[model samples]
Target chain A: MRTHRFAGYLFILPALLFFLAFLVYPLLHTVYLSLTEWAGFDLKKITFVGFDNFKLIPPDWIFWKAMRNTFYFVVGTTVFLNLFGLGLALFLNNSTRFTHVVRTLVFIPVLLSPVIVGVMWSRIFDPFGVLNQILEKLGLIQTPIFWLGAKNMALVSIIGATVWQWVGYDMVLYLTGLQQIPEELYEAAMIDGANRWQMFRRVTVPLLKGVATMVILLNFIGGVRIFDLVYVMTKGGPNHNTEVLATHLYEVAFWFNKMGYASVISVIILAISLVFAYLRSRLMSEEKA
Target chain B: MRKTWILLALLLLCATLMLPAAPKTTLRLWSWNNEGDYPAVFEQIIARFETANPNAEVEIQWVPYTEYNEKLKATIAAGDYPEIPEIHPIHPGSPMYSLYQAGELLSLNDALKTGFPKYFPSALADLTFEGNTYSIPLDVNNLTVFYNKNIFKKVGQKIPETVDDLISLGKALKAGGYMGIAHGAKDGWPAGDLYFQMLAYSDGSHTMLRKADFGKLTWNRPEFIEAALQILKMNANGVFPPGTAAVDYFTGAVQLFTQQKTAMFYPAGSWIVGGFDTGFPEGVEYGLFPFPRISKVQDSASTGGVATNWGVLKKAKNQDLVLAFYRIAADMKSAQILIDHSMIPPYAVNIQAKREILADMIKAQAIAQTRFVFTPELHSQVMSGVQGLFTGEVSAAQFVAALDRVEKTIKR
Candidate 1:
């Protein structure tokens, strides 16, 4: 029996070692780095400054701007994605030939890499691009709108591109949740004189709480860590108007070589993500209860 | 009889194994020059180096320009940098400066004592730190105005000789319903370059800027403010493209110029000469001219420095092979190869321009002045401030003051 347990441990050791090496070790190293001042090129040159990097965060206006932009993106993407995803899922709950085709079309953007998505959308948002051309043809405005160029519109444009890409993912998840609900629940609701809207509210929503929680958590985490799309699109430019936490971290770490300060920012991002994940677990447990 | 034959075969195998193996060395080189005719040029140089040293083999890794610095830094941090790593910018502001300061780069001083071709003094100064030469510049380039001849003819404007004339030309181009000048402010560096060009013209020298770079002087000087105001004035007059803040280097500025949407491309480097020869559309004729003088009392100097420099890693296993490679790369024959590919070599060579634009670029490089090397922090701050200026989010006073604030934080 002891030998059997030892054999099982031996079988799992490789994976456990990989997890510790790639994940846990890096996390601990990053925390240690956050407490030091280093140029990021030399490990021997690291100077322990004892939370000085954290102290710089509050006073740096760019950091505050990035935080605000990140918050806006997280809230914007999460709320809108859930709404559109649930709406589409409800409209195409019963799978058919047309619904299947539509579903594929909607999910197509999700299949594309974020870099491709960013490049495609940047062209679309160009001043003389298809979007402006259509708006001009329809006499929507006198001048072409600089979608990615304008300060107010840049973040909104990124959020829109992200939603267009990932809304289908949320839709597919909700579709699965919808299928998991028993047909008898809907039948009972209809037999009790409940209308379509009433049935949706009482039967569908209450039953999909678990999937909804998962979707929201995923979207929130994705939104918080958003990097590639923004990096490729705006590069946190036009006066750092669209700067987010991830892009700012990249700038400080790679461009500025302030790895310690960048590690501090990374720690904050990890903390935010962890708190949201904890809340998600609590909510999931409550739904089960 | 079979046992005797087996013993004889074993004796022959042992004799073959006793012979010494041939000595072979492989030298790895890393660079961001993968595009254009760079691959062909590098191939020729490597071919020559390998031929000169029969026992040596050369391996090259070409990284994309955007990701090269960060990737190189990561490799260095992991202690896996190649023997010959290309140090782009090759100035104090570059990430290689930190490596040099950390004693990670091999000093090329002793190597420079013999067999190396004469390089431009300014280019050599750029690669030298604290009296020690750290890298050798493969090419040097300076910025000049690239004008679309078709647009110039259509607008009936002549090449500007002074700031007033340039502004007038801009107005004429705008009035003709064309973009006056294409400035890629979105990328940050181009915008900062424009500002620095103006600052150089404003002060008649890069002295003030250099002083500020060394923390000996504040950035909020009269000349700095004047340069900022000039950018704003040009913007206010509709001299730039619509939504100038949104335009980037490649898709915006180069595209606009090649497509005949812009009358001129301002403050572009000599490195783009090769790109233009291939990328320009048929019948789209372009010409180069020096940046117009901003002050009548001072001569307008081109803002440029060396590019595509090479530094040897101190931990490089094959130092002699690395030195041999550098010797081949820094010679007149290598200069000729670079010239054939439309790259301006830092070494003195008999340059005969095949194209009119190349001739103009050569003329511009003759009068080019190297700018001060800014720290990375100051560089970023200046670039961000320039973006703000282009977007009209900050005035000249505000821009300089912000730079001063950032400058105060540097430890010097």
Candidate 2:
């Protein structure tokens, strides 16, 4: 038994070393930086100002604006992404040639680079772009609308593009969950006079909870720390209408040269993610019990 | 005697081996895509410099323009910056100022005095802080009105010379179903120049912004408010295109201008002529002029000055080699090279005009030199205020007030 345990430790040593070097050290360093005021260029210039950077966050209107935008995206991306994912999975859950083709087509956007998706969507949202031209040709609108110009519509446009890109990822997970559900449960419910809707409500929802939880948590984390699509698409512009936490952190760190404040924002992001993950694990354990 | 000669040869060889080797200095240079063919031109200059100084060598790193600033800041934070890096004159909050404050930039006073002429006085003044010069002036770029001659001919109107004429012309072009100005406010930096131009044209002073930086004046003054109003007026008069807020510089404004979809464009530099030549749309006869003056302002001026300056690291080991390179870069020969490559050099040099528009552009810059210095930071507050003006989130009064608020936050 002692020999076996020693061999297991030996086998895991390389991976453990990499994890400590890349993840653990950097995380601890970032936390240390959050307490000090540094310009991010020279080490000698760093001043230890405990909690001063975090104190600046509450009064900073830009931080609140970014927080609000992040919250909206998190809520918007989670609810809409899950609904669309489940809907698409239900529609194309069968083993047919048509379903296979549709699934491949749906996954194509996920295969595209995020930056490319941002640029493509930005062009598509242009006033003279293809979408507007089609809309105009169909006589649905007399004039082209500014998809990314308006304040209310910019976030909506970003959400639409994000959903289009990530919904397929969710669909694949839900589809697997659906396949694992035993057909006997459906037949048993049918014999007990339960209709399709009742059977789905009673059986499908409960059985798919694990997959649903995974999808929501993954997407929720992605939405909370979102940066790339907003960056390549809007760059927190049109008067910062689309500023999120990650973009704001970038601006603070690089543009403003305030590394300490950026670390504070990073800590906030990490804490939010940790709390969500912890709650998820607790919920899963309770469900098992 | 033959044995004696052999022993002498061996002694000489031993002496040669005893002498220390000459240390070959390696200087790392970081630059971004400032213009077309310019990077190649820079590489050639480096090769020539290397040939002249056989004991030294240079390594150039090319970074994309979009990510250059971020990457540079991170690299510097990690204490791994190259010996020299390209610095911008109008970086928001002034990255040059931050680097200088952190003692990361080398003072180039001795270098300029030794070799380069006093060609970029305004730029030098801008980069100086507390009696220390931080960077070497490299090139000058002016913001000008690039108008489509065919668009003007279609409307049967000459290019506007004053703000009122611009507005009237814009209205006429709108009536004719064309955008008056192809300005993109999506990036927020381009539109701020309009406000500065207005202030400089009206006030006849380019120091208002610098004054604000020193807390000598607030932004809600009547003149500044008038400048903010001028932008709002332009927006209200249908001068800018629909969805102007969504269009960025590369993908939207430049595309529309080149496609002849808009009549006028405010390209940030004269090098845009190169862009026009490469992607020549048929029947597109473009012209350049300084931004027009407001009709009511008696003293009118145009905003013009250096766009970017190169700086050396303070603790860089290759100071002599870097200073030698600066001397070469600032010489008239390098200026000629710049003019040949379709870039406006910081120093004046005799060059045959390749095109009539290039000559016109050079003449326009000379005229603008006397008018006003480039005061980009003066309008940084207004840059942020553009979306509010477009979205009706802030009134003109509120906009000016917001600028005042922003002024208070500037770290000088």
**What is the DockQ for all candidates, taken in turn?**
0.50, 0.54
For residues A1-289, write the lDDT of model 1, one tens digit per residue. 9999999999999999999999999999999999998877777899999998888886677888899999999999999999999999998888699999999999999999999999888878876568988999999978878787777888999999999999999999999999999999999998999999999999999899899999999999999999999988888877788899999999888776788999999999999999999999999888878
The segments of candidate 2 whose C-alpha lies over 4 angstroms from its true place after superposition are A1-10, B1-26, B34-37, B54-58, B77-79, B89-93, B296-300, B367-381, B407-412
lDDT of 2 at B54: 88
Q: How far is candidate 1 from the true structure (C-alpha RMSD, Å)?
A: 3.7
Give the interface-residue alpha carbon RMSD of model 2. Answer: 2.7
Q: Per-residue lDDT for B1-412 in model 1, tens only?
A: 9999999999999998997868778887898878667788889999999899988888899887667768887888788868888884444656556677577888889999888988889889888878888888888878888888888998889988877787888788878888777877877788888888888777765688877876788888899899998888877877777676677776777777777778888767656666666667888788877778776777768888886788888876888878889999988788778877777888667868676666666667778776545577677777778778877788999988877876765555
DockQ of 1: 0.50
Cα deviation at B308, candidate 1, in Å, is 1.3
Q: How close to the true structure is residue B323 of candidate 2, measured as C-alpha lDDT?
A: 83
Model 2 complex DockQ against the native: 0.54
lDDT of 2 at A57: 82
Listed per prediction, chain B TM-scores read: 0.90, 0.86
